[model samples]
Target: MALRTRAVLVHRRTELDELLDRHATRGQAEFFLRTRGRTLADVEARHEAATSARSAVAASVPSDWALAEVERTDLDRFLFAPEDVVLVVGQDGLVANVAKYLDRQLVVGVDPEPGTNLGVLVRHDVGDVAEIIGSLAAPRAGAGEGPFSAVRCDELTMVSARLDDGQELRAVNELFLGHPSHQSARYVLGADGGAERQSSSGLIVSTGTGATGWCASIAHDRGGRRLPGPTDRALAWFVREAWPSPVTGVTMTEGVLGRGGELVVTAQSDRLVVFGDGMEADRLEVSWGQEVRVGVAERRLRLL
Candidate 1:
């Protein structure tokens, strides 16, 4: 018999659940919201919508497939198989949060609250997920252009940061290297061409997938040109608030990275950190003399 497909539904807590968790009771939660001139009814309604969306997704999973539901916080502990199909049922950020943890597993991003979420990553609606999942399972004739093709999984670029100590982290959106507290960080920034010792707020290394986000803002602030697209197979780097002192020059502030291209940073501070996809809790730490290399990851996000 063939191995059954496994679907892992990823989700996060709703606001109402958080309120109840904090207050310890529905009555107390409602009262607390009331005191702030906000009604519990609104939160309740939002929770109901989310619940409905979750139910729709659960009901749509193929009966023959193995199913599991994972809370966003517990993803670190969840043991995913190589064949698992990941489903993210939250905002676009949730998609980014989970993508780094996966190794080429097909991700179906479902927008739980379509009415409110911009959902650039979580673009599919709950109603359409079953069909999308089915399509991904079915073999195709070409690059999802045939009449039999019901879905197309766009391969998004990703970045990886490998430390000299062999520690590594991947990012679907971008990677941040600097002080965890966003303070002045000193480092020797370098590439294949040359290296420079500099002091700055931090550095943001982004994939084409992250061009419209933090990278876009940085590009705009510096009067730089627009960044690469989501599938551009290149990475962009920007130094945030690079302090131009007599010692720290600002010439090496921004650039693009591709295959055989990488940005190396040698830590000049007592403590520096490398984190991917805005997840600070999951990070790699480097000491005063350590170094990290950031470049495009070998793996890509197969978005269904």
Candidate 2:
């Protein structure tokens, strides 16, 4: 039997949804914001735009394709197949959230409010979704000139952290290894085989796709260190606020990691966290005596 093509629409809850979840009622939510010198109009407008964009995407999906909808919060529970084509309809962060769950799946990012959101990753406007999907669904004819050529995508690199316990996690942009409370975290960090013990706020392992976000900020603060481009296969690692003390050192603070190379970190704290793309709530906890190896992931994001 032939494999079925599934279309997965990944989305995150809107700001208004969060406010209402907290306040129970729209009026109450407005009142709570008003007390803080804020207005509900902005949040409501964003919610409306998100709703309109999602509805348009739903209508555009063809009937023949098997459809599945997964929220960002529920991504861990969703099972994605290799034949799936994922569509992220929201901010650029949503694309990052969904990328790790996919393997060889094509992703289409739709900006809900293009005028306000900078959407560096979510580059396609809502109107461009249909054409993009059509191109993806069409059969490829030749090399670069085909109607369905995969060249219409921006192939982005990603990072993966595998624990010694056999559990693994992938990041579209970067992976943060640090204390869950952002306190000083103690650990031994190593690249390839050389190692050192260090105390720092945390360690950031970033991919070329993540060079623009947290990694870029760290580089900017450190006299503007050079960073990799979005498609570069090499990864960059930075130790945030590495404190030099009697037992801690900052010698292995920052560097680029290419293929066949790896960054190893051993846990020294009672509890450490490894989260990706700024989603702290979704993370992996590393306790004492555990080791994590971070490197370029085998999978890549094919952004159309």
Would you list the clashing residue pairs of candidate 2? none
Give the per-residue lDDT of model 2 (tens digit) for 127-227.
87788767665664543422223445787889999999998889999999999999999999988668999999999989887888889999888788777
List the candidates' TM-scores in order. 0.92, 0.92
**Colliding residue pairs in candidate 1:** none
Give the winner by lDDT.
1
Residues 1-304, candidate 1: write the lDDT tens digits. 4456788999999999999889999999999999999999999998998888988898888887889999888888888776678888888999999998887677888888775674568888887887886775675354342222234568899999999989889998999999979899999999769898899999999998898899999999889766888888899899998999888878899999987799999999999999988889989998999989999889888787
**lDDT by candidate, in order shown:** 0.86, 0.85
Sliding window of 10 residues with minimal summed lDDT for model 1: 142-151
Off by over 4 Å in 1: 137-151
